[model samples]
Target: MGKSATAATLALAAARTGRSVLLVEVAGRSATAPMFGAEPPGYEEREVYDDADGGSVRCRSITPDDALVEWLSTHGFRRIVRRMARSGLLEVIATATPGVKDLLVLGRIKALEADDDADLIIVDAPAAGHALGFLRAPVGVRDTARTGVLNRQAREVLEMLGDPGRCRVMLVSIPEETPVNELVETSFAVEDEIGLALGPVVINGIVPPLEGLDEPLPSGPPPGVSDVELTEMGAAARLRRERVALQGEQLDRLAERLPLQQLRLPQVFGTTLGPDELRTLSDALLEGVGSLEAWA
Candidate 1:
């Protein structure tokens, strides 16, 4: 599925069962807010929409001030994150490349996602670098301090991440070579260094219809086809077919290496995608890999 698709899945997964969850939009261009129909975006925990039954799916603020303060408070760090913020630490850190911002954000996300009773908490993590910060934060803290509030917080976050029963890392990427390569590289790096379990690799924006492959190839000698036209069309069709086949093969390799669940989403042939599109993506995600309903 696409990022929006994954976000929707995680959101519903959070509310699955009888737990309350927060879909934290901490960083990046588009957070999960768009998936649920929150517009005129702001930085505060607001209920944009609800599950089928209309229960709230909280959209939290992404501003530094809010992220630090709220995260500390909810994660029992009302003072710690605040103190860090006041000391200019959080500010300086937030100003760093996005990945760092993601650590702090995920720490907060973990605060909410970590709730035992909560079904799932989806955080639209920062870019690859920023996300790495969150994924590897535990190692930094665990090796640095013997004891302290930050240390404790880091430890809790680390433990939560390390435990497979609780946390799962979903690496999102396109079927293209670059993104696929990065996904594989990121997976190995995260696992070997952080000892974190990489759950599913979501391959988004898959290409041209493959479910129609055997229906007499769009290439095979068309009725009354000219040699020249047939040659070009056949070549194009063959290339398209090869690309799709390669994506599937690569995806299979990724799944085998990590033994991660693969969620592939078809290319949306739309001029633009908004809430309606997100809803569509969300529906596709839920159609399989069923999880808790957002309002359950």
Candidate 2:
């Protein structure tokens, strides 16, 4: 949810600036789809949001099997594609290849970008540990297949990923102990392993400061007439305040350690994030990171 929120916020920001944006979910995850209150996106692209100015954001989930079938179909191997899909051999092959899944997904993204399908594409990449493998797939294939179409495709994808103007990798994290630590480590890993600079570190789930919680509590509940209940409520507020302070401390530590730009998204207090909450998040992102025009 943390990473997906950041991705969706960024997509909305870009769309507001009159740009056609594509929000992609890699790693076969459903985080982005649920945020938009839609069924999880399948292999094909679907419009998720449309703005008044004729700008829109589309979402799609890419998987190795689907990409392979699409690729084969384009090459006049439709029957083979169907056979592989129906026989369950596609999953086996995708599983056997270490980074092919990631490479296929990257190829899809590059095609979308190159074909002018979207002015901007925001990818909700895998979590830190798996993301490293995903980012390295292009380089791995480029190095191994030196004289074939695969090698050429890999080279192109690598160029797109390494181009700062074209691609910016953002790391999303929460203001918690483990997520913060993983963000730091993943930042380093991305730079060292993938040779790409992180654009920003989006810190989500920030607890808003509690107002009027510091004042002295009344001796008794005004209408409920239960001192015990009042005391419990006060205790809960104090605990929430403490948590907010701790999160602030964690943010400070992250700022001191990481040299990347940081953006904070407040903790959304609800069971699910709908259009309203997404708009609220986009507003926060715009305030913190400025307009998406700069990126465009």
Prediction RMSDs, each to the true structure = 5.8, 2.4
TM-score of 1: 0.72
Residue 197 of model 2 has an lDDT of 60
Predicted structure 2: clash tally:
0
| Residues 24-92 of candidate 1: C-alpha lDDT, one tens digit per residue | 555644456666666635664666556665444666656555666665577676657766866887677
Worst 10 residues of 2 by lDDT: 287-296
Candidate 2 displacement at residue 188 in angstroms? 0.8
- Candidate 1 regions with alpha-carbon error over 4 angstroms: 1-5, 12-21, 28-30, 54-56, 70-103, 113-118, 208-239, 290-296
The TM-score of candidate 2 is 0.91
Q: Model 2: runs farther than 4 Å from truth?
A: 88-97, 223-225, 291-296
| Best candidate (score: lDDT) | 2
lDDT of model 1, residue 103: 47
